[model samples]
Target: MITANPAPEAGTEARTGSSPVRAVTRRKKRQWLPYLLLLPVVVAELLIHIIPMLIGVGMSFLELTQFYIRNWTAAPAAGVGNYRFVLQFDEASGKALLHSFWTTVQFTVIVLALSWLLAMAAAIWTQHAFRGRGLVRTVFLVPYALPVFASVITWSFMLQRDNGMVNHVLVDQLGVTDERPFWLIGDNSFWALIVVEVWRLWPFAFLALTAGMSSIPAEQYEAAAIDGAGVLRSVRWVTLPNLRSVNQVLLLVLFLWTFNEFTVPYTFFGKSAPEQADLISMHIYQNSFVTWNFGTGSAMSVLLLLFLLAVTAVYLLLTRKKDVDA
Candidate 1:
C-alpha cells in the first residue's frame, strides 16, 4: 500500500513563499544605499554654498546698505542700478574698480610666471638621485606647509622698514640698498606682495610638478641624453610633453587662486592696502565692509563671478580642443 504523503506545514510553506520577496526587498535596499550615503553631502552643499550664493545674488539686487541692514528684506529693490553704477568707467568707483582689476591681472601674471619657473626648476633639480635630495625636497615644501597667517605675518614683520630682517640683509649685509627702504608701502608694496605670495605658492607647484615627473619613464631621459640632449632640451621634449595634462590643471588652479587671493594682502596691509598693491579681492572688501556699500560690493562680486566663469569656460574649451586635436 502506498503511504499517504504528509501535507506540508502552513508556516513552512509561508516561509518558503516569502523568501523571494525578502530577497527582492534586500536588493532594492542595496540599490538605494549609494544614494542614501550621498544624501548628507548634497544637503550640506545646498545649505552652505547654494543657499548663501542665492542670498548674495538677491542682496545684489537690493539696496542693502547700513540703512536697511537690520531689515534687509524690506530694503528697496535697485534692479540693475548697482551694476550700472559699478560699470560706469567714467565715475570714481568705476575707475577704482578698473584699476584694481588691471593691478590684479598684472599681479596674477607675475606670480604665475615666477612660481611656475621656480617650481619647475626645483622639481627638475630633485628628479635625479643625488645626495640630500630628500632633504632638499623637504626644505622646498616648508613654505607651503607653514600656516598662512603665521608665515604671512612673519613676512609682514620682515618687510618692515626698520630693523626687519629683509632690510637688515639688503642694507647691512649685502649693501644692496643705501637706505632702509620702505617695503610695505608705495610701489614697493606691490613687489613685497609678489615676493610673499610667490614664496607661499611655489612650494605647492613644486609638489605637483614633482608628482608629474615621477610618471615620466627613466628610459625617455636616457634616450634624450643619447641624442645629445641637455637638461633644457630634455625638459622641453621629454618632461614637459609627458606632463601636459598635469600642467594644464596646475596652471588653472594657480590662476584662480592668485586671482582671488585676499588673505595675504589683507594681512600685510590691514584694511587699506596701497593703490599700487590693491587687488580686486581687497577692493571688494573695501567697498563692502569698509565703506558699508553692500549693494555696490555685491554688484562687483557678481561681475567678478561672471568674468571668472567666462574665462574658465574659454580656458576649458581651448584645452579640450587641443586635447582632441592631439
Candidate 2:
C-alpha cells in the first residue's frame, strides 16, 4: 500500500474496464437478432407481392401479350402508348373504360352509403343492454360468415326471372308488378347487384362499428344525459364524435373494396356482366383474358392502382387537416 498500490497493473485494469463495452456490443447484436430472424419473411413478401407488382408495372410499359407468355422479356416496349389509349377516351375501348369507371363510382357510392347507415344503426341498437343480445349479434354476423361464392350464387338463383323467390314474392304474392322483373338483365341488374353486395358487406361494417362502440366510455353518455340529451341527441353529439375517426377509416376502406369488388358481380352475372353493372374489374378481365390484350389490361390495372393511391393520399391529407383544425 505504501508503494502506491503496486501502480495498478495496466493490463488488468484494461481487461476489467472492457467488460461493459463487450456487453454493450452483445446487446446491440441481440437487438438486431429479431430483424435477422425476420429476414425470411421479408424475402418471401418481396418474392410474392412486391416482385410481381414490379413486374406488372413493367409489363404495363411493354407490349406484352399471349404471344409473349412464354418469354415476357422479349415483349416490345410501349412507352406510355397504352396509357394514352386508355386516357384519351376517343376509341371504343377507351369509351368503354370511361363508362365502366363511372359505373363503378356510382355503384361504390350507393353501396357505401347504404352499408354504413345500416351498420351504424345496427351497431347502436346492439350497444344497449338487452336479453338475447349476444344471440342477435351472432345472427347478424351470419351473412358475413357465409362463403362469398355460396352466398352470391344463392342470390343469383333467388333473383332469376322465372320461378325465383324474389320474382315470385313480388309478382305472385305481393302483386307489386304484373310481370316478372328481369333482375339479372337490363337496368335492373344494377340494383340487383347492389342488393346482393349490401347483403354481403353490411355485416363487416356492423362488426367494425360494434368494436368501436365498445371502447367508448359510459361516462360520456351519462354526461350527455345529464344535459337533457335524448337518445338521438346523445348519439349525434357524443357517439358520433367518438366514432369520427373509426368512421373515416371504415368509409375509405369500404369505398376501396367496393370499387374493386369482382367476386359478387362475377359470380352473380358470370363472365359477361350486364353493361349496366359492368365493373372495372370485369372490364379489365374481359379485355385481358377474353380479348387477349394483356398490354392494354396491364395499363388499365396500373391506372386503377395509381388512381386509388392518389385518392387515398388526398383523403388522408384532408382528414388530417380537419383533425388539426378541430
Candidate 3:
C-alpha cells in the first residue's frame, strides 16, 4: 500500500493497446497477398490477349492494306466502311463473305450434332461395369490423345484421291466408284473436313460426358430400376436430367470451338480452299494474308466475335430457363 498507487503496468498497457492494431495489419497483408500473386498473370493476359485484340479492333476501323502495310499508323481511318462493305451482300466481295459464313454455320451445326450424339453414346456405354471397360475407355480417348497436326496430316494422306486407304478400300475392295472421287477438292472437301473434324471432336465430347457421368449418384439409377424402368427410359428420365448442366456447357463449348475452327480445314486444304468448304476462319485468313486486306479481315473477325457473344448469351438464358423449370 506504501507503493504509491503501484505504477500502472507499462508493459501490459502497451500490449493491450497494440494487439488489435497488429491483427488488423496482418489481416490486410494476408488479404492483399493473393492479389499480389495474381498480378503477374493479369499483366500477362493483358499483354498477350487483350492488347492484340484492341489492336485488331483499331485496325478494323482503319484502311490497312498492302498499300499501307509498311506503316499501319499512317493508314486512313475507315470508320464503319469496312463493316458496311462486309454486311452488304449486293457487292461481289460481300456475297463471298456471306457465303463463307453460311458454309461455316452449316459445318458447325453438322459437326456439333454428330459429335455430341456419338460422344453421349460412347460415354453411356462405358459407364456400366464390364470386362475390359478400362481398356475400352482408353481406346475411346486415343483420337483426342493424338496430336491434331499429326492426325490431320495422316487423314489428309489417307483422303488423297489417287493412292489413299479410304479410296483404296472404297474403290478397289467394294467397287463403290469406277473413278476415284476428289476428296480434297470440290464439294467432297466439305465432307472430308466434316469426317476428320468429327473424329477429332467426338473424343473430347466423350471425355467431358464421361466426367459428367461419374458425378451422377448410383442410387438414382438403382431407384429407376426398382421402378421397372428399362435402360432407355432410365436414360431419358434419370440420366439425361442429371447430365443436363454438363450437356449445356458441353454444347456451348463445342459450338464455339467448331464455329471458330481453322486448323483442320487449313491443314486439309492449304492456301486455297474450295468454295464448299471455305470456312469463315479460312476466309478471314485469305482476306488478311492472301488478299492482303487486313482491315476487312479484322472487321470480319470482330463481327464474328460479336455474333458468338450474342449466341452465347442467348444459349445461357435458354439453359437457365430450362434449369429453373427442372
Candidate 4:
C-alpha cells in the first residue's frame, strides 16, 4: 500500500527543500555583488592607467604631428624607426637624441650606486645606538620629505656659481680662490645633479635597510664572533645573507624611482642638464611638453615603461631564484 506522504516532520523537509534555493540565490547574489563593486575600480584603472599605456604603445609606432595625434594624410608607419633613432643614435635624428639616451643611462647608474652605497653604509653604521639617532634619521629623511621642486630650488640656490653660498664658502672663506664653477651652466655638471639624487634617495634606502638590520638577531653576530669571525666577516656571512631580500627590493625600487624622478634634475638644469645626468623622464618631458611633440613623447614613455618592466622582471627572477635556492 502507498504510504501517504510520511507525516511531515515539523519544519524539517520544508526547511531542507528551501535551503538549496536560498543558498543558490545567496550564492548568486554574492557573486554578482562583488563583480558590481569591482566594476568601478576596474573601470577607473582602465581609464587612468591602462588606457594611457595602450595609447602610448600605439603612438610609438606611428608618425605624428607636434600635437601627438597622427596626421592621417602625412603619417607613416614608423615601426621601430623612432626607437632606432633614439637607441642607435641615428645621425639623421641629431646629436641631441644620443645625448639624451647616454645621459639617461649615466644618471640611472650613478644615482643607483651612490644612493644604495651611502644608504647601506649609513644604515649599518647607525645600527649601533648613539645619541641623536632619531634626530639623525629625521635629518636624513628631510631631503626626500621636502617637496621635489622646493628642494630642487633650494639646492640650486646652494650651488649657484657667482653669489652662491657654495662658491662663497669655497672661494672667499675657504681660500681656494679658484674660479667659481657653474652648477647648472655647463654641459658636464653631472656632479651637481648627482648630488641632488643621491641626497634625496639614500634616506629611503637607509630607512629600509636599517629596519632590516635591527630585526636581525644579535645572537647570530655573537655566535659568529665565537666562531672566530670579525665584524666584517660576520657581516659578509650573516648580515648580508639576511639582508639580501631587503637589499634586492630596495635596489629595484630605487632603480625605478631614480629612473623616473623628473622634477629634481629638470628644475635644477632644465633643457641644459649635463649630458651625463639627463634622464628618460626629462627626455619625455622635453619631447612632450617643451617641444610639444606629444606623439614622440608618448613613444618615449612606452619605451621607458618597457625598460622599467624589464628591470622589474630581472628583479623578480633574481629574488625568486634566491628564495628557491634558500
Q: What is the lDDT of residue 177 in candidate 4?
A: 65
lDDT (Cα, tens digit) per residue for candidate 4, span 194-298: 888888888888899998899999999999999999978987998899998778778877887877878788788755556566676776776666666555666
| TM-score, model 4 to reference | 0.81
Least accurate 10 contiguous residues by lDDT in model 2: 8-17
Q: Candidate 1 residues 36-129, lDDT tens each?
A: 9999998999999999888888888988888888888888999999999999999998999999999999999999999999999989989988
Off by over 4 Å in 2: 1-27
lDDT of 2 by residue, 1-326 (tens): 11324464643332224587875566556767768999999999999989999988888898877888678889899999888877888889899999999999999999999999999999999999899999999998999999999999999999999979999999999999998889999999999999999999999999989999999999999999999999999999999999988888888889899999999998999768999999999999988997676778989999999999999889988887898899
Query: Per-residue lDDT for 284 in model 3?
Result: 89
For residue 217, give model 1's deviation from the true position in Å: 1.4
Q: Report, for every candidate in turn, its global Cα lDDT versus the true structure.
A: 0.90, 0.89, 0.89, 0.76
Clashing pairs in 1: none
- 1-326: candidate 3 lDDT, tens digit per residue: 11324575644332224587875566556767768999999999999999999999999999998999889999999999889988889988899999999999999999999999999998889998899999998998898898888889899999988889999999999999899999999899999999999999999999989999999999999999999999899999988988887888889989999999998888888667899999998998887898798998899999999999999988898888877887
